[model samples]
Target: MYRTARKVAVMGAAGAIGSNVVQDLLSCGVASRIAMYDPYEPGLKGAAEEILHCAYPDADVSWTTDAAEALTDASYVISSGGAPRKEGMTREDLLLGNCEIARQLGRDIRAHAPNAEFVIIVFNPADITGLVTLVHSGLSPSCVTTLAALDSTRLRAALAQHFDLLPDAVTGCATFGGHGEKMAVFKDGIEVAGVPLAEILAGRAVNGRTMSPDEWNAIKDRVRNGGAAIIKLRGRSSFQSPAHQSVAMLKARIECSAYPWPCGAYFADGPYAHVMMAAPVTFSTLGMTAAVPDGDDEDVAALQDSYRHLCSLRDEVIRAGLLPPVADWTSLNPNL
Candidate 1:
């Protein structure tokens, strides 16, 4: 794949997720300069040194404890902040602390890299935190996004396995709404072997087996609970998949890839108004455009539920004093 030269910054570079993101950025050879920031000097130095050993091509990498130094002149900012989710902990459990972290980090980005074109929030409770960042960073809704693609990728993987096909063969699969358990996984949007999943569910056999509605429903359940399952098996929240997807998002944004990823983007006036949630979005030089999936009535209802949940979370942030009221949003970021 071809890549362009740009100044990229990674927040929390010393953490597990951030280190993996740094490694992927280097290996992809996209940015001309990769700047890493973390308060922990020793871990940051170690992570940078580790990447030095790999000697990936076409990029210069540096580490810093100072946020401004790392972010100044950055073209893109990929940030993973807050603590990782452990077993039995829902994303809501990590909300308040992560909100504060996101608020301060967002202010830092505003103070330092106000001109940066895009930002990706990859921490726990990203839908909420991404909004916090967007508000405080004073960036337009289109300029900042979050890692909703992970849930869609999980959908892709689940469909691939159920159909006995390679992951790449599971095309057009997407989820919309929150990236958490309430996300809407649209079976109608999925395709395997170039055939719509709804067709397969309607007695069109694939791999010599027609899927029953029960099986399709089970797959949807799996997609919704994918993150929790990962923690139960891996003993930590995901890292490798998140790293790959976030970098792929970077590649898509910079290259303007035609494929629209399911991402956590702000919806201002549509059904998901004033909420940052997942939808099918393609990035380009002009900014981002979202096309919410026209799912079935049930799926649409699910999306609405997800939206209400996210709105509640946003209100919680407001009540906690992490942000101003919705009426004041335009004052902080006029583009919103």
Candidate 2:
């Protein structure tokens, strides 16, 4: 039941992450044609050549400087283009520049690949950039999403290490809200070895060592600061994990499988209106639905804080002239 002759487009396909994304998409073996778009001619050509050398008969790989050429007829689009963050910068610091990039990319997608089933935003400040893209793309919020699961995955790793267990032993780790410092890491939402983290912190010892509340707080801090830690350790922003996770999201969308990871999706109505925030969710060709967490008041408050933080960022973008006010959003894209 494989779909035939599907075209998948990768924006910023020449960069470190984008190149890896290109290869990953090829490995998926779902797309009969893979279109790569990057303005950097040398990098784009080199990436295309390297993949061509592999000679995957299932993929008809093509690179282009033309946005329309790359995007036309694409079934799904993954964008990771924009300036990379440096050591001292927060995700919000990358906002102004990256949102402009996202705005233009969205316009191109609207013009050329309006029917693209899913458009994933992966550059820094993905929540804001994702909102920018969704507004300009003239597509419904359900058709667009952003990569925000890295924080949750980082939290999962921290929990596994704290419990001295294999990573898979930790489950139900969820991160909500923005993908930056303001994200909410819900301890009650996670389990180590199928036991609640809150219970473990209360008294239960795992492997003869109990985790105190302070220890749990430290783990949350580590998850929040994980990206900066990576940049300090590696002298560059992260690429591989983001690339892999975004591609996994696309694959899930195509196969209609449940996505265990959190995704940044639009909230048009409710407490989080006019912002994009990550939440537990399911995806399909039709759209996405963010799950209401079954946790306690603390979880609700933390998620609300993250939502407010994201709203501030979104408002900043609007005020800076990057986008019109929220009232005009529907005018820009009727689908919203």
Candidate 3:
């Protein structure tokens, strides 16, 4: 349990994921106070009311249209404020608008919550949003992380189902790179009931059937496209699962869990200079500490490719004037 009472702020508290996150936070009793901000005034008020009615009536909840008002003195800031991805839309399709949203929110958070321990990005093209937030907020890359845990969770569920094992038994599974289709799922260090997953899957028949290499590829592809599949079926993007993932991450951060799961798009320096891609990270009061060197060769290669893709996307955003130039960033933070 956390000893300190902290203020948690949600930037898009009216939206599907944001409202669900608010409920999760209150239900988990993680925050002493929660400030909810949404540009849509009515939606914000309604969401707050609904949350209050459902749980934690005594919880300190505030709703606002102003980012500064919500972010003031916040310990953790979650950015879920942006347009949802439509049925036929790709994550990149939502990039420009969401990046603009994140850019302004980052500026406000920097001004209002300069000392916030973590700024979590939950919007689409999460890697880019995280990068924009890191640069615009003028915070260390370590202070920001994108919600990649959803992908990891999806992978674990899919693998567990494939092998007829419980999800908890499938441990040490990790998803790296961007939060989109390019993200890589790593089986290294993964275990099932104290047995290595690779070993268990090797020439093993499950449910009177053996999973071929092509079937494994199909499973991974399904994991990568899980969000899109949900959107296609439901006519909107996911909400509850992502909200749950966000709360889990918040719990890990607040409790200082020793075995923090891998999250998407964490800011990297040293060997992963000028990049914010998915990797294994432990959250602390200072910010996220990544285990970049823990990846196997395949993971490293996929991560580098994802990094290159993110760089290209950043360049595109810079060209559109949505974000500052690389030179400006380097000038501001020479350490990066």
TM-score of each: 0.95, 0.95, 0.91
Best first by TM-score, ranked: 2, 1, 3
Name the regions of candidate 1 deviating beyond 4 angstroms.
Answer: 85-93
- Per-residue lDDT tens digits of candidate 3, residues 1-336? 323368899988999999998888877777658899999999999999997787564678889998898999998988888777666877566888788888887788779988888778888788888788877887776677888787778888887888787888778877877777677677778776666656655866644545667777888899889988898999888899888888778878777886446775445456556657778887676667887736678777876776677778888889988877777785544434
Off by over 4 Å in 2: 1-4, 30-32, 86-93
On a 0 to 100 scale, what is the lDDT of residue 321 in model 2? 87
Higher-ranked by lDDT: 2 or 3: 2
lDDT of 1 by residue, 1-336 (tens): 327567889998998889999888767755657899998899999999998888776568899999889999998999995766566877566797898999998898899999888899998789999999999998887789998887788888887888788898888887888876778777666778888888988899877767889998888888888988998999877888888788888888888886556888887787788888888887778777777667889889888888898889899999998989999988988888
State the weakest 10-residue window (summed lDDT) of model 2.
1-10
RMSD of each: 1.9, 1.9, 2.4
Cα miss at 135, model 2 (Å)?
Answer: 0.5
**What do the candidate models score in CA lDDT, each in turn?**
0.84, 0.85, 0.78
Candidate 3 is scored at a TM of 0.91
Pull out the clashing pairs in model 1: none
TM-score of 2: 0.95
- For model 2, residues 1-336, the per-residue Cα lDDT tens digits are 223368888999999889888887767655557788999999999999998998777678899998899999998899998777666887556788899998998899989999988889998788899999999999988889999889989999998888789999899988888876789887775778878888898899876768998998899899999998998999877888998898888878887889898898887787778888897778765777776554678887998888889889989999888899999999999988
